[model samples]
Target: MKILIVDDEVDILTLFKDVLESVGHEVDIAIDGESGLKKFRNKKYDVIVMDYRMHGKNGIDVAEEMLKMDRNTKIIFASADSSIKEKALEMGAVGFLLKPFDIDQIIKEVEKIEKN
Candidate 1:
């Protein structure tokens, strides 16, 4: 699946990109929500793995805009903050992964979305 990962942490970005690429998935990394949104506009991704807390635009804000443009967009929140899961889902996120989670969890989530 084509996946976009948006987060402020370089480590997180590199880790996700490495794992997703190793699994033969096309992966793109953005360090912030704005850039992630820009890439979303420029290309089509099967799923977006984003963090809820980010600089400038949060995941909710970005997802809201993305959903506006394409209501079918599949966004999964990979955030340390679990408090926003309900809100994220309500805002159209397909899944939520609380941080410090297993790397395989993300792959599974992406695959799950890919199947749908």
Candidate 2:
């Protein structure tokens, strides 16, 4: 699977990249929404794991823009804020992972989307 992960925190980006790659999935990292969108425009990903809150554009903004470009793109919104899950889904996110989620959880979510 190919995945794009967008997060402002370096640690989170590193951890997710390591975990997802270890499972034999191709992974790309973007530190902010602008960079994420740039990368998204350049390549195709099976799934996008994005942080809900970021510096320039939030996860919702990025997801919305991506959906505008391709409504079939699958997005998984990951955040510490549980309150945004509903909003994220309403904006077309396929999944939501609360921050501090484990590798298993992430993998499960990705696999679920893959199967669908």
Candidate 3:
């Protein structure tokens, strides 16, 4: 699957990108929501993994605009805050992973979306 990972932290972005790429997926990383959205507009991604907290445009804002353009893309949010879980889903996120989620979790989530 082609996946886009958006996070302010470079470590998380690299880690997720490496792991996902190693498993035969094409993954791209963006340091912020708007950059991620720019890439999103240029490519066709099966899954998008985003961080809730970002510098300029938060994940919520980015995901909202993204869904408006292509609602079929699976958006999986990974955040430390559980408080926004409901809000994320209500906004059209397909899955939410709390911060510190394992690599397997993301893979499974992507695979689940891929199957559909």
lDDT of 2 by residue, 1-116 (tens): 99999999999999999998998899999999999999999999999999988999998999999999999999999899999999999989999999887778998998898788
Per-residue alpha-carbon lDDT of model 1 for 5-89, expressed as tens digits?
9999999999999999999999999999999999999999999998988899999999999999999999999999999999999
Listing every candidate in turn, what is its Cα RMSD in Å to the true structure after a full C-alpha superposition?
A: 0.7, 0.7, 0.8
How far does residue 39 in candidate 3 sit from its true spot (Å)?
A: 0.5
Clashes of 2: 0
For each candidate, the alpha-carbon lDDT, in order, equals 0.93, 0.94, 0.92
lDDT of 1: 0.93
> Against the true structure, candidate 3 has what lDDT?
0.92
lDDT score, candidate 2, position 10: 96
Q: Indicate the residue-level lDDT of 68 in model 2.
A: 98
| Pairs of residues clashing in candidate 1 | none
Candidates' TM-scores?
Answer: 0.97, 0.97, 0.96
